[model samples]
Target: MKIVKSVLILILFLGIGATAWFYYPHYQIHKMKNDSMEVGKDLSRETYLDYYRQYSKQDIHHLAIGDSIIHGFGVDETENLVYKFSNQLGHEINKTVHYTNKGKNGMTSTGLNEMIKAGLLDEAIKTSDIITVNIGGNDVLKTAKKQDYYGAVKSFDTLQETFTKNLTEISMKIKEINPRATIVLLELYNPLPADHQFSDLADSLLPKWNVNIYEVAQQIPSSIVVQTTKVINSDNPQNLSQDGVHPNSAGYTAITTQILKQFSKEYRKEAV
Candidate 1:
């Protein structure tokens, strides 16, 4: 009788331990996200534009849209894709490039469509020489809640359809607004390292989404999808930030290189 009682007690303790193990991270993530939204809420899009006007009195406008990657989420202004690319392009072309960023932390593809519909992106898009997008991460991220790879995969299946539709619509809208503006969509990377529990599934699923991004870019005029997985999120994830989700200094630098490469490719084609 005592032996059976001991086994039952052990099982109960294990169950409780497992529960705490999973939910603790989720709770922390929720808290951090809420705090970030609260902070970002006050800093409106117009504020960023006016700040740009103060520093650089130039007509060159480069608008960065989409999620936190585009927003430079866990990094300083210098370490963000927007500033790095803008600065490099300015130096390369001998033009003063004014950068405008409309990166939201928890944005999905649909959210981006809504933002465009609301005319939040109108002035920025119309004035932009180049428009960079980093979206669809949150769409897949919403599925990570299951903590079960199989379940997460299933969740991603549903999100894939809507993500494709919304992203296509977004590209069409951008083209309609400004046909001359080059649209560069950042490819998805597996933020979770290979050894991590959900890494394999994330890697497998991310590429599927990338194909959609590539296809959409191909269909849209003056648009290209920049690959990020091989550069930012590698086998060891060396370029990742401390959070293992966002990019570090090296990762952002890699991103800047890819963006310039795509532009160079077009410039060469045009010159030839």
Candidate 2:
């Protein structure tokens, strides 16, 4: 009788703790929004275009797709890479350049392929000049069997195959939708090291994952692969985030600059 009672109490405590962990961060954000101390602080622009004024409503250039990176999960809305890319491309192209970002948290390459198959990519491809994809991190982040860390590391071959197939399929679908659209595939970056908590499990597998992204990018035409691993690793990524998983404003800025440089070079070449 006593053992049963203790087990129930332990389960209740764990459930409470998990709830707190999940909601506390969001609660803090809400509190900040309501707090009068932050009035007139100007965290971000009121409109997306305010931060990316180089593009006009009629002459927008591209569309951005992928997961949390494009979503600006850790950064303010105006400081996202999509806006930075647009601002830089506008300068290089000598025309108003706009980009529509369609990013979600925890999106994987498999999910992207599914979304395309479901016609989610149709509208964006039809109207956009260029498309940039930044998926694959979550696909690589999947564990093989809950606690089977070693097994996950060993399954890179399978993961790589799936990633390649998905990228190829997405490229083909986009071409079919709009043959003139150029696609830019952004490579994966690992913020975790061997010494990091998740590293003993994922470190060996991550480099292989990144390499697979590079290989897959080579197989697609009209696609430019941009690498930002060095920039993300320049500082301890863990320190750059409020949560250990997402990058903060500074990290987003660094990554935005790295990608903007690449887009500038590519746009210049295309213009000439």
Best candidate according to lDDT:
1
Error of 2 at 77 (Å): 1.3
The C-alpha local distance difference test score for the whole of candidate 2 amounts to 0.66
Clashing pairs in 2: 61-98
Cα-based TM-score, every candidate: 0.74, 0.68
Candidate 2 to native Cα RMSD, angstroms:
16.9
The lDDT values for all models are: 0.73, 0.66
Best by TM-score: 1
Evaluate model 1: give its lDDT.
Answer: 0.73
Error of 1 at 52 (Å): 20
Give the per-residue lDDT of model 2 (tens digit) for 36-99.
1222445441222232243344476689888998888877777777877777667655567777
Candidate 1 C-alpha lDDT tens digits along 6-75: 9999999999987775455445434432432232334332222233343354557889999989998888
Off by over 4 Å in 1: 1-58, 146-148, 266-272
Please list all clashing residue pairs in model 1, or write none if there are none.
Answer: none
